[model samples]
Target: MFKLIAFDLDGTLTQHRSKLDQTNRKVLEELDKKYKLLMVGAGGCERIYNQLNCFPIDIIGYYGMQESVMNNGQLKIVRSDFYTVDKQYFIDATDKIREKFGYTDYAGDNVDFHETGAVTIPLLGKSAPIEEKVAFDPDRKKRAVMYPFVKSLFDGFNVFIGGSSSFDIVKERFNKYNALTAYMKEHGINENEVMYVGDDFGCGGNDEQIKTGGLNYTLIDDYRNLGNKLAFLL
Candidate 1:
């Protein structure tokens, strides 16, 4: 009964910042025959598209701030939204959190300001090694303890424990739930006809919004088991 199948990229489809393997790519090829496959991710549309090795699917990126579609065998951005952020405010606030949590010593920049007006506070610093970041909060327990406090500090932004060692902050109106709903409304598709697949649905997780928003979704705990988890869909 589903017409659309959306997905989260990083932890759901592949290892963090890794390429999509042939196994999952083949699974997607099978799914594409029966349903519209869309990529809904925390990163930008172009980044997701390339990571998938240009698998030929539409992408909703930056939690809905950007939308792109495949046209003529190439990805094209059809819609994009940007918001201005107070850089000083984010830097000061992140510093406060780092000091409180004893994460004051980091490798790179304290915060990452994206072109889309989104912000990220990398706990291990922006330039920290990938291995270190991955090990920093595998269970998200470290971020969970500080999630509430971070949210309190960034009242005007939607805060999520994103990636392995960072907090993703966006404007209040942007989130996977809102973005997916908007896509549904635009396409005249009913909510029940859509199924979202993702991994990060835990506390302060980026995909938490969609899960909590009551959407029909399949959780992927291990990317290696993605095909098995979604075998019923196939």
Candidate 2:
């Protein structure tokens, strides 16, 4: 019943920031034979394409700020949208949040501003060791506790609990729901003809909007079990 099967890259198809595995890759490959496969990601198009090891698929990135399509076996940037963010404002606001939350002694830069003008306020600082980041919010409780307050501070941006220990703030115009809706409109596909598979569909998660937005969604709890979880689809 699905015409397009969209996937969230990290923690859904593979481990966070990890390459696509052979097992899952083959599943995508097989699924591609029958359905149009797409990647809807929170990161950039190039980053998602590279992480997939150049897997042939169209990608929606930066929560829909950018898009790329596979043509002639090469990934081509078909659309790149940019938003100008007040960097100093973000830094100042982050500082305020940090102080209020007793996170004044971070390891490095507090705000990570992306090319798309999206911001990631890494609680542990950007340069902190990966081990520390993984340990800091393995269950995301610490950040989730501060989600409402932090989101309130950024009035116009959509805030989400991101990565292992950070919050992603994007323009109010974008989110996974907007991204997928745009995709469906562009492709002339109905909502019922699409399916979204993602891991982070809970509260404060990046995929939460789409999961609860009246669409057909499949939740993935573990990346390693993705193939089994979607076996019926194959």
Number of the top lDDT candidate? 1
Using TM-score, give the best candidate's number: 1
Question: Cα lDDT for residue 204, model 1?
Answer: 85
Tens-digit lDDT track of model 2 for 128-227: 8877887787667898899989989898899988888789999988899999999999899999999899988878899999977888889898888988
TM-score of each: 0.98, 0.96
Clashing pairs in 2: none
Clashes of 2: 0
TM-score of 2: 0.96
* Residue 160 C-alpha lDDT in model 2: 89
What is the lDDT, from 0 to 100, of the residue 192 in candidate 1?
93
